[model samples]
Each structure stands twice: as structure tokens, then as C-alpha cells.
Target: MKPSHAIQGKTSEIKLLIESYGFVSPAIFGSTASGTDLDGSDLDILAIIPAGMRGKISLFDIQHLEAELEALTGVVVDFNVENSMPDHLRPPIEREKVML
Candidate 1:
């Protein structure tokens, strides 16, 4: 099912931002993809970040990106580095993944 128009637009903006950062195979999951979002629902993103870029991303860098996405999308964002995610976390995200 398609997400609401507002969320869809925000997701698009987020995808563009992630793309600009050169992260590949960005996917969104959780409430954003499930269409069960409430007023406080946050956006969940999984990205296949390059190994070279991996070392460059820190808590601070991730925080900065999160802030940028929130500003651009008006939604709280939870960003996940696909390679770093635990095996258990992979299943649910994969099941509902919306690859951008």
C-alpha cells in the first residue's frame, strides 16, 4: 500500500538527500512503509553505505544527517547502516522494505 501523500513527499525528499550523500540502495521501512503511521511515527531508513564511507560516519555524522532529514521531511528519522544492522533486525526491514 502507498503511504499518505505527505509522508510520500517527505520520503522522496529523504531519498534525494540520501542519494546526494552517495549512499546506495536506500530503503525505507517501519511505519513509513507500512502506512500505519501515527502523529508521532518516525521514519526508518536503511541504506547500503559504501565501506569507504563507513569509516567516515560517526555518531556525530549520523546525528547531522538525521537533523538534515528532519528539517527536509518534517519527520523524525531513524537511520540504519544496512551492513551494521543485526541479523534479527534485517528480517522485518527486508519484509516491508521500500527501496528507493
Candidate 2:
């Protein structure tokens, strides 16, 4: 199955997972977003936290979410936080991201 379809099939679970981790605006980028994902391709995820919740979250929380998501999808996951990412990396990801 395509990566997007795999993700879509687990959308509700993913949504709940992200919300539980205080992440909002979940998106998929890179190969999965562009429909070119092959088996073993890592899933690239971008998520933003609401300003109000930012101070409450920790790195461990984010890493836990990443691991949980990878377990859920049975694929490697590369999770990126929009707020913490370098400015230079934003535009290209934004250009290709598919919102979840």
C-alpha cells in the first residue's frame, strides 16, 4: 500500500496521538507527501504546537510521540516541530506538506 493510504487508514489513531502529545497541525512531507514513498522509506512528519502549550511540552514528550507513531505505522518516522526547526528548512517542507 502507498504510505499515504497507510497513514490515512490510521488517521484517527494518529490524530489522537498527536493531540495527546500537544501537537497540532500535523502534516506529512518528503516522499510520502509526494506519492513516491517506497518500502523502507522513512515517514517525514511536521507538527506544530499551539503557542499556549509550547512551554508545557518537553523533548521526551516529542520523542515518545515519534516512537509511538512509528510503532503505529510500522515504518520509521522523522518528526519535526515547526517552531523549533531552522528557518532554512521551512519553506521547502511547507511547499510539499500534506495536511493531516
Candidate 3:
């Protein structure tokens, strides 16, 4: 799919995944976040899973999330999962992920 379509589709899927995972934090950051630039970019989503969910998370689960999102939207979505983040650290990471 085209990058812009991928960005929009991935952003929507990320939001739904966050909700399904029961994240209460009002600010989940993805490609649509302020200061995030999507020109020639891949999807970068920063999600704060619930506090008690800290170390219990799995990379496989994240991979599955990405796969599910891709299947639903026909867009490849990537994510970075963190737990109990302080309000300040959220934006920068989502905006400036290294594409390597």
C-alpha cells in the first residue's frame, strides 16, 4: 500500500489495539501524533500498556498485534511498547524513531 494510506490505516489500528489492551492513558502516540512526520516514513507507535502489565508483555504479542493490524488494514504497522511512562517521554520517541 502507499505510505500515506499505510500511515492512516496503521494509526487507526494502533488506536484500536490500545483500547483493546485496556490502556487508560489518554495519550497513546502513533504516526498521527503532533510533531510526527510521515513523509517517506514507516509506522512508529508508542503505546503505554497498563502499569501492572510492565514486564509481563511479550515481543510475540507485539508481533501479533502488528500482524493483526496489517491483516485488517492491509498496512504494515510497527510498534514500541513501554509501560507506565512519565508524560514527558512519550512524544519524542514516537516522533524520532530510527528507521534501521
Candidate 4:
């Protein structure tokens, strides 16, 4: 399959996978969401975990999850912790992120 935007068909599958791994509110952003993705661009994923479940989802765990997503989507996946992102990134992320 070719690279795609943050449409429901693509996002829904990723959303299910993310939730299964205990991540909450999964979303996609950057060029994919902005409708300018190139063949080489990676998928930008922004997500957070429930406060109560944070301990179970460590950085390593998220990295593994990101690998899974990359494999499934056939695109490099860049997973980001929503709360940890820089303040300056919030606006662009808000403007670009598509809810999954």
C-alpha cells in the first residue's frame, strides 16, 4: 500500500493497535495530516497514556509499539508523548493532528 494521510481507515487500525498497547487518544500529524507526505516521510504519531496506566507503558514499551506500528503501516512511525512535546510544537500539532 502507498503512504496515506490520517484518514479513518488508516487511523482506525492504528488506533486499535495503540489502545491495545494501553495508549490513549492516538493521533497522527506532520506531513501526513497536512496532506503533503512524500514517499520517504515517516508517520508522526502523538499519543498519551491514562494517568493510572503510565507505569505499565514505559519508553521502551512505546518504542516497541512504534516498531509494531511501522511494520503494520509500512511506514516509519515516530511516536511522541503528547505531554512531553515542546510548547512551541503544540500549536502546529494542534493544527495538524488528526484524531484516530
Candidate 5:
């Protein structure tokens, strides 16, 4: 399933999963957001950890959330931290992302 379509009707679940891991401003980008996803395409998701909570969240927590989201959406998930991403990649992704 397309990432957007796979997530349909699952907003509350997705939100809970995101919040449990201390992430906020969840959004979809790349092929999923651009409506260009093909079979086997991975879901590109951006989630932010608030400045105050940054160090409190662990790499394990992030991986756990990624696994959970992949299970929920039935797609490979490429989860990323918005703040930690390199500068050059931000513009196009920000322009295309669909906030959840």
C-alpha cells in the first residue's frame, strides 16, 4: 500500500505511538508525500524531539518507534529527526512534507 493510504484511519494510533516516544510534529515526505511511491518504497517520516526533551530520548527509543510505525503501516519506515538532518536536505523535504 501507498504510505498515505496505509495510514488512513490510523491517525490516533500513529499519534499515540509518536507521543509515546516523545516526538512531535510528525510528517510524511519524499515519495509518499509526493504521490510517487511504487511497490517496496519506504515511508519517509520526520518527527521532532523538542529541545527540552532531546537528550532524554534514546536511540533505542527511536528504533522502537520506527519498528512500531512500520508494523502499523505495513511499509518500511525511514524515520528521521528533523533537527538532526543536514541543512541541504531540509528545504525540499520541508516544502513537500504532509503534516500529520
Candidate 6:
């Protein structure tokens, strides 16, 4: 099923936020992918920011992101920030993500 308008709006906000941080990989995971469900679901965002931006993101920034997402999409949004991850861990997590 296609994602609801709320989910799509949140995704767009997240994209803009990621862009503001200079992330260009286009490898973002979660609801943007096919088969995602919108109702009663949260967003999962994973991106690799520049070295200088690492460890600089604070809890307040995350809270702000969440708030912005809620304001724009009217659904709860969650963010996970990481510098990198093991290759083997990516697929399983992405595959098992609960979008519905």
C-alpha cells in the first residue's frame, strides 16, 4: 500500500533536514521504501553526515527535529543518527523494519 499524505510530508521534511546537513548518499532507509504503512508508524532515518558534523548533533537538535516532523506530518517521528555501521547489519535491520 502507498504511504499516507502525512507520512509523505514527514519524509519530505526529513529529506530537507538531511539536505541541510549536507547528506547526499540517497541511501536513507525506512518509510520511503516500498510496502511501508503510514498509520500508527514512526519514521527511521539513517544517514552519514560529514566528519565535522559528527558528534555535534545534540539531544535538543533531535527534539527539534521530532517537533518539526510532528508539526508538519501530525505523526510521531523518530530519528537515529550514526556515523557508520557494519555492512552485514544493514540488510537485516532494513528488511525487518516495521512500516505497517
Q: lDDT, candidate 2, residue 69? A: 92
Query: Candidate 4 vs candidate 6: which has greater lDDT?
Result: 4
When summed lDDT is taken over every stretch of 10 residues in candidate 1, the lowest stretch is 1-10
Model 4 TM-score on a 0 to 1 scale: 0.88
- Give the per-residue lDDT digits (tens) of candidate 5, residues 1-100: 7777888898678878897788899988999899999878899989899988979998998899899999999989999999899999999998999888
The lDDT values for all models are 0.76, 0.86, 0.55, 0.81, 0.88, 0.57
Best by lDDT: 5
Choose 2 or 3, whichever is better by TM-score.
2
Error of 1 at 50 (Å): 1.2
lDDT for 71 (candidate 1): 72
Write candidate 2's Cα lDDT for 2-99 as tens digits. Answer: 56666867977887898888889998899999989987788888889898997898988888998999889888888888999899998899899988
Candidate 6's C-alpha runs over 4 A off are 1-4, 9-13, 21-28, 31-34, 84-89, 94-100
TM-scores of all predicted structures: 0.83, 0.90, 0.54, 0.88, 0.93, 0.61
- Residue 87 miss distance in model 4 (angstroms): 1.4
Model number with the top TM-score? 5
In angstroms, how far off is 65's CA in candidate 6?
1.0
- Candidate 1 residue runs with Cα over 4 Å from true position: 1-5, 10-12
RMSD of 6: 4.7
Tell me how far candidate 3 lies from the true structure as C-alpha RMSD in angstroms. Answer: 5.9
The TM-score of candidate 5 is: 0.93
- What TM-score does prediction 1 earn? 0.83
Between candidates 2 and 3, name the one with more favorable lDDT: 2
- For model 4, residues 1-100, the per-residue Cα lDDT tens digits are 3357333366678889899988789988888888888877888889887887867888888889989898788878899988688999899899889887
Ranking, lDDT, top scorer first? 5, 2, 4, 1, 6, 3
